[model samples]
Target chain A: MKGKLYGIGVGPGDPGLMTIRAKELLDGAQVIAYPVKKPGEDGTALEIIKQKVDISGKEVVELLFSMNPDDEVRKRCRAENIDRICGMLDQGKDIAMITLGDVAVYSTYMYLDREVRDRGYETEVVPGIPSFCHGAAKAGLPLMIGEESLAVLSMAKHDIGKVEKAVDCIDNIVIMKAFASIREIADMMGRKGIPLSNATVMSNIGMEDEYVGPLETDRKYGYFTTVLIKKKVN
Target chain B: MKGKLYGIGVGPGDPGLMTIRAKELLDGAQVIAYPVKKPGEDGTALEIIKQKVDISGKEVVELLFSMNPDDEVRKRCRAENIDRICGMLDQGKDIAMITLGDVAVYSTYMYLDREVRDRGYETEVVPGIPSFCHGAAKAGLPLMIGEESLAVLSMAKHDIGKVEKAVDCIDNIVIMKAFASIREIADMMGRKGIPLSNATVMSNIGMEDEYVGPLETDRKYGYFTTVLIKKKVN
Candidate 1:
């Protein structure tokens, strides 16, 4: 019998936030896969599941991933990784690839899911709590309430123009991975007269360096940072 | 110490999709509250928890919530419910209010959370797997990937105009509670010359009569319908 590939979301760095299905699948899986910037580097997805399930005896597969802007490099690396993962599946090993948030949302596993499925392997995507929900919950803010509209955008450097247009129409906005462009976002909010008080900046949520507060344009923030902006003007 | 309030999300109808934190809190809570349209009505939130945790001997608080369009009625009913909840807290009885999906997104708990805090009560919101995530996972589609922007709008009757503007700017969009405006949305999609192939319509996800398919304008969807539209035009 062929093994099925599973993409599980561990949720925003909290083992408690992980769905029961995710933990259960990870416990039973023969091979565990997660992305890392380089070989030997620990990933957050692993740390999260480690807190709840004792995976000391399980086989760990560290898939090298790149956040580099070059399309060629990313495609080549992803292709190589999928080939390696497919080899394990060929051996009838149930491989479970874990991600930070919902695998359907901005996850590297999302790209690999289609590729693995095309190779004639069964695939399942297990949904998890997205980081933005944790940011909203920690900030005690409603992501949206009573017909309010929400726009979630990945903020790149100089991506202020798209944000401006979204701000014009969307009632509330959550900008994920704001580490690279947090200063630019703060500047745009300043120029547009959007209050910093309206923003909830979360960095490394549920981690040791976790910070949930107003935007600090002058200071640098760790990855896993998200800035949630609520339009109080309206 | 005053009794604390908890808002737990049971997740889009699948008991296994519920976060470990949500299930753990519910298991220990003495008073379990869930919203219903009328007294003695069975809510999906209660049904979801029943599959996982045994709450048969625990106290059940049925919060009467109306989907009425009238603002005055909603406000009056909400005020009464909050007052009753505050009284329970006054007696030092902990209340766990359960909601569908994340409590921070379009849940009645969002409104009550603020009121409960203002009355000197502690409130905790445990985020859950949103229905949209499950919809995307079920359809085998990414909600947003690689700098893509997502707009999540609650669609009301005659709300096609807002969606049109969002379609112009957002890369992908998820319209929650699309039952009332499904046909109008179908008409708008056709009028704008956008292909229906890019849309995934999910109705009553993970429940009996659950339907996931392309837009069928002729059929009437249930109240839990959500339409996920991808802007392939961009």
Candidate 2:
């Protein structure tokens, strides 16, 4: 029996937001695996998965994926993780690897996918509502329009210039994982004469404790998040 | 009594791909509205919504939105559609207006949104998976990875240089609705040596009789669609 692997995004946090396809895969999956921040902490993705269905019969695998992108450290971690996943697959085990957001958009599951494909294993991706989109939903803003394009960025400082470029080129922009870099982004948008009045920053979208408000805020949020800015006046 | 408007994306023909949030709004919405291509032709979004839920109790409003960008024509269509939607909302009606892909991503809902907002009404956007992301999922390709940016473009025929700029600036490029301009885009990517081998063209994703293959196919698909160009070899 040829084994198969699933890259399933559990969505940002709310289990209800999980795609029907993802929910089906999670409920029927024989093996469930996800990347965790450290060794002991339960993966947030697993928690999201549990909200959807019973994972009792599924074999849970913890794959360590360091957020830091140091070449040596990441390579070592990915190799070990891929080995564990590939081993399960080789045994005809159907594995569903849960991710936090959409698998194609800035997801770590891509690394595992590359490894699996390289080893001649079959792999498929189940799309999810990107947290950025969820944030836009929560914030009640349109990110793009006719002849308008949107860009999704991350927390890196270099992303600031890209945000500027997107704002200049596109109709709207969404910056993901921007909690650490919101201050700089907000400042840049302000300098660019982009009104902060309508700009929205949402953290932990779809979660019970979701925060949605004007981008310029005194309260600090540290979570998987998005900042949405629309150029057109609402 | 409060009037509410929901901008819901019905996804690309597959009812399963519709987000739970989109489904919730669709079910609870009192007024169902969508843009019609012509008087008698079936609205693409209407078909998707019909497959998922019973629209028996809801009022269906069809607004003609011809793709004429002429100033008078656009203003007149925009005004008429906006009036119809706002009229229902004014009567404390909960309205869910359907769009094909995500309402925030290259959607005509933005045009309606600006009109509604101009009429002094609050609108909430429920994000759905964009056509491009759905297309990528169907093709089993990742759009972006660590530190790499993604750009979505709808370029004019003479805008190949602009397309090149977008490709150069971003890691992964999704040229949406570029079926007419495919040869130009394909030629540009080839001239730049940007791995056309891995590029995939997906039209009508998640729909019945969808097409997913290399862009160099003899058959041509010119419709609501997207192209995924993977930036790096995995």
Candidate 3:
């Protein structure tokens, strides 16, 4: 029998935010698979799990995933990772793949999950709290309410336009990977007279050196950053 | 010396999906407050907490908030609830106001939190897994990836136009309170040549009689229903 795959979302960098199912799956997994940019260092997802469940005795495998700007390079890395994951499934190892935030969101586990399923291996995607939600909670603000609409987009040049379009329709907006386009977003919102207090930038949420404050373009922020824009607050 | 407010999210109706922090606050809460419609019945949020925590001897308060279409009635009811809550806090009773999902996202707790904060009481919001994320995970589908964007809107006649606007831009959309506008949204999606497979509706997520399936306009769904629309699928 081929082993099953559990794509568990460990929550947005918060160990305390991890679900009961996430902890149970990680604790009972025969093998642990986590994405790591650097070979020896644990990724954010693994770091979160470690804070709750011990993985010392488990077969922990660190897989490298490319975050290169080039599309081809990223695709190649993903294909190679899929191949490696399938090979493990054939060995009857119940592998648990951990990712930061919900796998249903932008987590790379979504792609891997489909790949594993296509190869006739069983897979389960366990949902967890996303960063934007946690960011809202931490910032003491509501994302949306009472007929309000929201748009959640990746921060890119194209998204700047989306923000403009979204502003006309959406009452709230959350931009992930916001560091690269932080300046433009802050300026655009500033131009619209949407006070800096209405827009919040949270970096490394629930992690060390976490930041939650008014939108600022002056300083550099970490990779895991999210910007939230609200039209109304009480 | 007023009581603090903890707006706890219990997670999309699933007991196992509740976060460690939600459990801790509830276990330590001096008074538990939950929204209820009928006088003698516990709402969905309270029922979920009952599954994990023993509220037998704890101080549990049931709040009534009008869901009537009349805006004035709803506002009147909210004012009353806030007044009642403030009275509790004045007594230095630490209240744990639990909601169905993340308090920051369309939960009634948002209004109460703001009101309580305005009255000078500290309120902490603990995020939880939302129904849409859990619905996507339950359906074995990804909400969005790469540069794909997502729009989350409440189902309404006005939102039908938002969907039309969103279809041209967003790669994914999630509609909450979908039961009311189910048919119209389905027909619109159908008219736009979006296959039913691209949209998945999950009702009573994580609760008993949970459902996950293609968008069906002819059927009736519960209050907790969420509809997820994906532009593409693998």
For residues A46-97, what per-residue lDDT tens digits would candidate 1 score against the true structure?
9889999888888999999986789899899999999999999999999999
List candidate 3 stretches off by more than 4 Å.
A69-72, A156-158, A190-193, B69-72, B156-158
DockQ of each two-chain model: 0.81, 0.56, 0.75
TM-score list, all predictions: 0.95, 0.89, 0.93
Clashing pairs in 3: none
lDDT of 1 at B121: 94
* lDDT by residue (tens digit), candidate 3, A1-234: 899999998888878899988998898998999987656775768777888898988998888888788989988998998898888889998999998899878878888887789888999989999988999999888888877888898875446887777766677889898888888887788777787678899898765768999877787888788999887765
Error of 3 at A188 (Å): 1.8
Which of the two candidates, 1 or 2, achieves a greater DockQ against the reference? 1
* Tens-digit per-residue lDDT, B97-213, candidate 2: 898877766677777775687678888877776777777776777787777777777763346676676666566778777767777877888888886776788876765557888
Q: After superposition, how far is residue A220 of candidate 1 from its true place, in Å?
A: 4.4
Clash count, one per candidate? 0, 0, 0
What is candidate 3's lDDT per residue for B1-234, written digit by digit as tens? Answer: 998999999988779899988988898898999987667675788888888888877888989888888989988999999998899889999899998878877888888888789888898999988888888899888888878888998875446887777776777989888878888888888889988878889887766668899877788887778888888865
Angstrom error of the Cα, residue A196, model 2: value is: 4.2
**Which of 2 and 3 is the better model by DockQ?**
3
Lowest summed lDDT across 10 adjacent residues in model 3 chain B is found at B156-165
The Cα RMSD across the true interface for model 3 is 1.4
Q: List the residue pairs that clash in candidate 1.
A: none
| Model 3 docking category | medium
For candidate 1, give the lDDT.
0.88
